[model samples]
Target: MMPVQVVGLGLDGAQGLSPVLQSLVASAKLLVGSDRHLAYFPDHPAERLSLSDFHSALAAIVRAAEAGVSPIVVLTSGDPLFFGFGRVLLSHLSPEQVAFHPQVSSMQLAFSRIKVPWQDARLVSVHGRSLEALTQALQQGAEKLAVLTDPTNSPGAIARLLTSLDLPWQYDLWVAESLGGEDERVQQWPLAAAQQTTFAPLNVVILLRQTQAPVLPTALPLLGIPDVYFASFADRPGLMTKREVRVLALGELALPADTIWDVGAGTGSVAIEMARLGPASQIYAIEKTAAGVALIEDNARRFATPQVRAIAGRAPEALEGLPDPDRVFIGGSGGQLQPILSVCRDRLRPGGRVVLALATLEHLAEVSAWSREQGWHQRCLQVQLARSTAIASLTRFTPLNPITLVTLTRSEPSPL
Candidate 1:
């Protein structure tokens, strides 16, 4: 059987359609496409088919081809291979039976109209898919994103989703509607403004992440940061681990270029640091408190750890249905330490390490005993930090809360 060609007609107008593609459509014995696509070829006498009913249209294309139709032209928007009907058609018809003629996608035009480079941007389709995926992508520091909007998943809904997550206005959005049509329209605005505005039904949303101006280099050492780097809540008030303690805890975990779970992650200090140290690793900051979760997100952005995942909800309960970890750190497990430890230890691959930070000697003893019972090797450290302060007319030192660190490594062979 002769191959059917899937061609893209650029949104600019009929003239935007490639010459070769137009020729194919003109010579085709049968044409299958959307209502908009069919309107582009007014002079063709072929049996025009509407793609609104995809199953029937597909069957018609197959039947016409079997009847010796030399070339069946399938008209599509943008590049056929990019989230278009070409993939579905090719899956049913043999690849050898189809040819693809690509054109500039609405997403590409949207981005180009805004004059932003999209090489590093995350392109996602929100058409009839889970919004959770989009949430996860944004949470993982997706700077720029090209979202394909549908009737059910409109631009307004997407904007609402971002606003619900309290995402900052770090993006400039370009909404392109009915590209290539007489009613074509494009609107550009900051994310904050875009969230308040409504867009046309057929549109592509392009988000360009805002860039910060460069800062002069500082002379201070890089590893340990001062206490002020984090956003703290009044109730916990200094409950977050100190900068020095975080550095030591990160080292003890010996995180690898894999997945690390910061269970009971508070303010995501440890998780953010791990992401900074292990550039190739994914750090999951699992926190139970809403305030702590928000702090983790703020800290993650502040530290430029794009791969850190700030997860809301508590440990063990929140840790349900998470990916297995190569390293785990428990910072604030409440009283469900045993359950959290069990879940993390079970999820850790062989050779995986788990680090626990306890505030009291009693908790340290409990974890130590638990580690021995689990047949894991353990090491403990008591960290006491003293900061220089001015007392009256002289300089003095004050001791902060001491932290106990417990490190554990599983000796069992990995099944990865």
Candidate 2:
């Protein structure tokens, strides 16, 4: 029986193929591939079979080869065995009748052009596949990654997805387009710039995570700043209030308060925002954990919130020495939700607002009961935010922890 030749072509096309592989294609009795792959051997005398249905095409090629076709060539892109059509062909054609000739894969060319080692890199393809693998790697903060792009999951779209994520780690993104071709272009792109720019349809995206701790960002928004800029606990990185929750809490606080208190301040995110909004106001950040206290102090200095004072003690006790607050934000009650509210009730000035960001239903119920018993004017805003992300060519939503921002104001005391 005649052997079936499975040849891998690179972006550079057949002109860059080895003499042996070129000769095999040049003298083929039958050839099979897509239009782009078939276009390379236009002048060849072989009977061309344009591949549409994979199984049907393979069946035809096998029949031709077994019927004494001298040479049957199947043109596929890059390393035929690696994420290529050779695997499918092997499933139907016997190993003895199929020979694989691999070229430089797009992933290999990508890392080579970016000048980064690929031995430890995670290679993923969004071509006709789900994006779960890629999403997992990104969430785990993988060091090096190479992504094969399809027309639907283009470089720009992937870049846009990356920027939208609220992950702690950061990456330097690069795109290698038309690798091994005359019009090849390689570029290191800023995530923001890449989100708006168009890249070639034939491309691979590279992500190299920054090794060093990211330098704290200097340019700050007047209200809510990105959470990545904050230095957080190494053990529990996502312990602080999220940006969406913080934004709503800040609005509820109605800033410019003469004195603002942030109870259970983990990273001082809420306290820092208060200081930013009313730079002249004194911002007190109270925390029970020493590590949290230190983070608050460091984040305070990092964000230029000099007015922020981090108290290294739990609430009810920590609230004793601080002056009466014009506004109070209880981010974490540390299981003392009621006690913290009681302390806040005693110290909060007339017309002052106390906003609590409760993540659990228990905390919400506790705070709600306390507010009603105290007969306080309350307004509650429940925020359930879902961030948009890309899973290959499809867009999916990842839900953030739901939070209820409850605003409380003291009124005439009522029956318990």
Candidate 3:
């Protein structure tokens, strides 16, 4: 039987190739690999074959073995088991027919240079996958990521994606290019600056989650922090609902790990906070002002809630093309409370929850009457917050703005 050895060349350096691996490469009757790997065995008389297609390469290896070749060598990069070509070849060829020789991976070298432990980090190859998947992971606030990048999905592309998401935190990126080569270079920069760079074709992208990770929590808190804790834009200033009021509204909304719509979302404080509660859930902060949209993005990054998306147009108009929400929160309706509620009632999933926060009793009456007309159960709460502030070198009590909370739960009619 022909001896087939799968050799891993760690970053193409002399130290990365073992003596045994070197001997195998020297004795092989046929060498199958990329041009760079073939260059390693310049003295070997074996027929140098380039692997551009998997089927063609496999055919060449099998043909050499049938022709009385005692040994065949297939070259790969890094550890054969770690996102290398060995896995694919092994599936096509019997395990008993092949032997693997691994080397330290470039990923390991890159992480080592940065002095960060990577045993727990998530490693992904963007070689042939959609960049959208990376976006999804980023939205979930993936702390440690090692992205294997090509020229198409380079560090610049990643920076653009993060910038478009409007996440507030800065990323400390390490770009390691031409690793193990004499010309290898490793550079660190902020995400914005990284976007402006043009890295070598071969490189890895490392993101160090900064200290300012969003305030968003990974798990849902039974009672969330008050809305006052979130940073909001000055345009809608005090228009945001208080933390106590939001908790009551969220309770009635019964949020699920599906999708949500925060209509008239001022600064997107609630939307971002909701995303933090459930990483899998998608929160759309629908607001009309440019400043409000920017605020939502800032809050999402500040809280580490990447799942919150800010829509910069007005409701009814902005609501178009958004995923149907499992639950809806209407924070400020601008006198269109009834119309917005009417639209949301029809759009909401069956048995879904809708919570409305209003400052005036008149809007509460309007929403309550509308809910009753729709055969839905409505609940109301008047929340007043009295906070303590510093006065004359002593603490004094001050009243926070009072809010009227209304919630409507819709249920399907049961069979008579």
Note the Cα lDDT for every prediction shown. Answer: 0.74, 0.82, 0.73
Q: After superposition, how far is residue 193 of candidate 1 from its true place, in Å?
A: 4.1
> Largest TM-score belongs to which candidate?
2
Worst 10 residues of 3 by lDDT: 388-397
Which sections of candidate 3 miss by over 4 Å?
12-15, 66-68, 168-170, 213-416
TM-score of each: 0.54, 0.68, 0.56
In model 3, state the lDDT of residue 223.
59
Model 2 clash tally, residue pairs: 0
lDDT at 389, model 1 = 38
Ranking by TM-score: 2, 3, 1
Q: Which residue pairs come into collision in candidate 1? A: 11-180, 288-313, 288-314
lDDT of 2 by residue, 355-413 (tens): 88887888888877888899888788999999887664467898888988888888632
**In candidate 1, what are the lDDT values of residues 213-245, reduced to their tens digit?**
123236323555554455555344355777778
**Alpha carbon lDDT at 371, candidate 3:** 82
Error of 3 at 166 (Å): 2.5
Models ranked on lDDT = 2, 1, 3
